[model samples]
Target: MRTLFFRSASPSPSNSPSRSTIPTSSPRHSFSDSLMEENIEMAQTLITKWDNSDVSSYTKLTSLFHDDRREAKEYLKCVRDLQSAMHHFVNSQDSSAEKLIISQNLMQSAMKRLEKEFYQILSENRENLDSETVSSRSSESRASTRSSVSDLESESEDELMVLDADQVSSIPMADLKSIADCMISAGYGKECVKIYKIIRKSIVDEGLYHLGVEKMSLSQVQKMDWNVLETKIKNWVNAVKVAVKTIFYGERLLCDHVFSSSDSIRESCFSEISKEAATTLFGFPELVAKCKKSPEKMFRTLDLYQAVADLWPEIESIFSFESTFAVRSLGVNSLIKLGEAVRGMLEDFESAIQKDQSKTPVPAGGIHPLTRYVMNYITFLTDYTEILADIFADYPLTLQTPLPEAYFGCYDVDESPISVRIAWLVLVLLCKLDGKAELYKDVALSYLFLANNLQYVVAKVRDSNLKYLLGDYWVGKHESKVQQYAGNYERMGWSKVYASLPENPTAEISSDQAKAYFKQFNAAFEEAYKKQSSWVVTDPKLRDELKVLVAKKVVPAYREFYEKHRVGLRRECGVDSLVRYAPENLNNYLSDLLYGASGGGSVSSSFSTTSSSHSRGR
Candidate 1:
């Protein structure tokens, strides 16, 4: 007797094995038994061949069933022949329980063999497809190498080849998707997670490529035009957008097919991609610093901040948790950097002013130029403070609470609250103004300059919205300071004038002695009046206080002198020359003298000058 075996219907010459020959007629039991044994053995042999074969070859063989008509017909013929052989044995009179069991085992073995072969074909195709992709990429890389050879003639060929190989080995999206599909179809869904890792790595690489950090050093970036840097940053952000979209699409596909129940896996994959995107986006601050060579160019901070702020909505949509966290982190960091930069700028400006202070003298008639510049800078900071407050409005309470302490590095002494750090900066500037005022040669003039500037500062604070930052109490304190300066001016300015007065007279004096005393007093009063008459007092209340202070000091002393010396002074000079000024006239002169000619006011009528003429004999 001979044995029969099954074979693939459309076998390829390279992959298909030679079929065994069927047996001729023999004794009934032996033929049936031998046939059944051959069938079972044939099924096992086919299964073993499939298990041992490479997937590429198996896939090629399996593909023939769909592509080649003859192969499909041959495959169906093999199945039909096996079934017919089994039926033939079962129908026979000699078909006993033992024979039936052998037949049943043969059919089960054949089904198992077919199932195993089917999956093997899919696996083999996946590997072959990946291999082909790699080969094509290698060819492209080689072509690139050849193109670059002339330019890179001095470079090592081995180095160039290594670089090209690395570039080619990076998996493309299309190839990744194909492998993932094969894995999913073969019920090896967990294997598709590898595709997400590849995608996330590619996205990160893409982000770095767009960032171009190695292409330009920070110094080089600093020298770049702001517009050029802005364009580069916009391009980087656009590239990030593309990377985000690509990752989203890839993850969506993977999650739909492979990671449906593996949410942790999905989250892990997206988290990595989100971090890469954030890293790329956050690099913008370095670029902003580079573009901003000075804090005077603080608009760069604003522009960079605005650029990132605009993208936050999109980032949130794409990477909910990861991107929200990144944006908030960037915001906090940007706020800190902005504060430091602004602080540094103000400090530098202060130092520059201080350095120039001794070298530059104050003008005779106006505010110092540095004073004007610093005041203008204060105005800018006033607006900038509002911007900062608005920016951190949504920030954590801890960040918002100690913002001034962090920026100004000052404890909240009750006199200078932390919330009033801007006000403190202004106060510091005013102190600088005070230092400039001390450079004047004249003591009274120094007080006058201080009075002008201090009053200006007080008026600005009280009149403008800056009062809110500096506070009502700060303004009041400065206003009182201005009054103190005015009072100092009065005391210093009139000391010489008061010193010329005669001491209190205990006895009558000669006409000539009285003549000398009245003459010296008149001369000193006239000179003091001439010198101080042109000085300015800007604030009305300060002007009135100064006039009253001088009057109280001068009027009573002059009144006593006139009463004591009038009898002899009239005998020495004629009655008209007895007193150059009456007590009332001196009081009126004191009021009118120090205020500029423009300052107009009325003196009290109650104080009278006692004018005496020489009688025939007293």
Candidate 2:
């Protein structure tokens, strides 16, 4: 550049106008014409020299940028010079047609070098240019790009670029930005963008692959064993989070910054790189949703639902561009399909509870298997409350009839649509349990079964997330029902024992009547204790409460009967045989009643009650 300008400025004897010929124009105009002629005639020295040599050797392509950043700056300058030459060839009248051809050729060579450099930088520094780091550090402008993971050795390589491969960073972000801007402004933006899309897209797809997200057809997912499918669902739950949080996020940051000169290019490149991977990533849950609906698959569906629902904001933000709308649509579509599957599963689950035809009553009047299964299932549903609340808002409960008025009573299902839906499911389970209680032969044992199952339901609601959704009103009401069931059990089971006593303990009867009454009491006590010894209460608190209740009713009445009549009877002969049970003996028998002895359906004589009929549950 200096040689061309200086030579044109120096005196040229032939062009000095010979001092004889009059000048046709001003001295300033004459000088400008001479300068333009010289530039047009000599040809650009820079583009010709690079065109004639091996660009890789002279530039040491990778090393030049990484080791000597000054060479990188010089390279951008050469791009600018070529652009200037092309602008002149297009606009200047005096420019030779051959110079325009040379500039075009030189521009292509420069663009090729930039493309290769861009690829190498992205490839070699994949980890360094990771999404987490890129998104976090990308907020800095070109002035501060050197301070990021790919820090610059020198900031002097123009505003957008300076490169060095060293400790923490491979090459500063500025280097890529500079190359992109140079090529874009030089009428080669399309080529730069194409190279960016290819390389960055591979990184995105590979990230998804490593994260275990795959594009699976419906048949492919359906053929998988449930255990295998569940594992994949869990992996996808983790993968979708990473893809949105860091992978797509970083790619978007890089794309926007590099191609910041053109909004259309940035949008188009990001969509091409990320949309497919993201669509596949999100489309997975919808596939899982299409699998055979079962009670077991409900939790998996909820997990998928939750994962997508959780990352939806980021998904929307990253895929907001019109070109990437399919990704957004797929994400939202997955959520919709997942919600539908869950609701369908809910209906099926309730029907299964209703149709349970198992005639075999739980032994010892313990908790029913259906009771545990339904409560456990609904309890898990509570963990998904916020999501389910939204889901149920759109699809309200669709039972043939509204919930029974007395079912929830004062509790308002309308407070939250999901709340009512869950409450309805639980009520359906309770109704099924009521029908199952009829299978028990003894009315007393049936009442005990209801008490045991209801106690379990109350505790489950009290202890878990159900307490919040169902509220204290529901729990308090159900708890009272449990107390009523236990009372009915006590009354029905012990009525005969109470009837054996006299209406008044102090009313004096004859000697023979007293002896007859004492014998009647002894036989009744033994028979009732033996019959009830196998009955069970699964909740410890409820079991203890029932014991205290029955004790209050039975012990006092019998104790008064014993004290009054036994004194007179003991005076006669054979008193020990007549009075078979003391008040202390009654207490021992009551302790042994619910805890079925090791021997099934049999009462141990010692009545220590060392074994339990049912395991205690919350």
Candidate 3:
């Protein structure tokens, strides 16, 4: 019963049964047969001195183990010797049961000292043994594992370097490893593993806290306002990358290194240390996904989903044990929830475009408010094409009853499904704007509104990431529609102006008929010019192009009519009274139109009375 309290004094008594850990022998001889009896005497010195209450020897023994690292190795060697002594005693033909009990008691004393050393090493070297340094110095045999973890880290290398900058490798990995081997071999693995789990788990938990991760419940996230919640999501994006690439990654390396001699000890220890923290880190995204479903929220949500997927390989490799399976499941479930959230928001956005109720038309057939909102919204969505590709694969926009080929164009929708969906979103906005155009009372103004809005949408696509997804072909096709809308506007708005001029201005005609022709031209020109002067073209390139086209259509023809009739129209009446405009005047008037400014003094308002009299005379 000497030294009986050694086992009871341990923080957690070992329930693991004692196992013989002596090395295997050559086929020719038993290895334990050759070990010296003197090897057992070395450990007995400290065990007997302590148990016998030899105060001076006890103080010296404690000093040798704690203050001298050189002596620490010598202590580990004594444990190994004690282990061999016990085996030899059990297998010997002439062994005393009393001697075997004394050897066993000495072995327990050595294990108690070694267990204290193990806990001391872990507690004192938190920074020196941090995951960053540990993962970098991981054993060569785990090169494949380290390589895979490095791949996850490459996803966000600059987010937070995680103490690698001023790292000092002060934790002697070899010393911890040597002590672990001695204690675990002598059936004290439970005590060694318990100390490891407690200290390292705190490091893992605290690491997450420094990285800005917290244990968020579904209710807390659900009640968070999006503005506040979105800030949290951005922080989680950086936090998760650091947690996986540094925190869990370093721990996996350190645990596998220290307990490399026992696969089960290393696996179980790492599982307990990292599982809960990892689960909470990964579960944040899923909770965020559960909270909201809005188009405005989709981009930040995709960022969360991407963080999980990018680290999934590392998560799988680090937590590969059956004991840590819940960590891997947490990561995958996050991906699934974030994906579901993205799809829901996309549908919500599509529905919002179709259900718009802004009934009032934009002033002067300019860009509608909905066009600006939807185009800006959809343009930004194109930034997440790759993640959206995975999401949209399952929730395809079903074109059950397709619009006419003219509305969208003949481009193939199958080349990329993502492109098709974005194209469809733009089409829905165009359709919504088409409904808005109808609110304008003037048919010409309706075409002008469509032209102005379509030009805005095309310009948005060409300038942003949307250009890559929608392609130059899509851009070209819509650009032509913008021209087509402008053409329709010009044809309807100026048909009366074209009608007032003679088909053949140089053909000989009576002075009275020529006077009437000049009279009719001024009235048609003034009214159309006055009305169209208030319309707008929002895009600069389109605006300049429309001004040029109207000049080409009107300028030369009006110039020809004036040159042919000058003498006859002056003889018919005062020429200035009938010809209110020259060829130069026509160009000037067209320039002043379509800028959203109301009527300036008309160049030809004097001709309106003559035009009214002519209307009655006709």
Q: lDDT of all the models against the reference?
A: 0.52, 0.74, 0.74
Model 3 Cα displacement at 323 (Å)? 1.5
Q: Per-residue lDDT tens digits of candidate 2, residues 488-586?
A: 999999888887788786688988888887777777777888888877776777888888898887888888888888887777779887788898778
In candidate 3, what are the lDDT values of residues 95-161, reduced to their tens digit?
6487688888788777766776677677767877888777666355344443433343333324423
10 residues in a row with least lDDT, candidate 1: 607-616
> How well does candidate 2 score on lDDT at residue 43?
33
- Model 1 over residues 61-96: C-alpha lDDT tens digits? 554222342432343334444555567667776555
The best candidate in terms of TM-score: 2
Ranking by TM-score: 2, 3, 1
| Residue pair clashes in candidate 2 | none
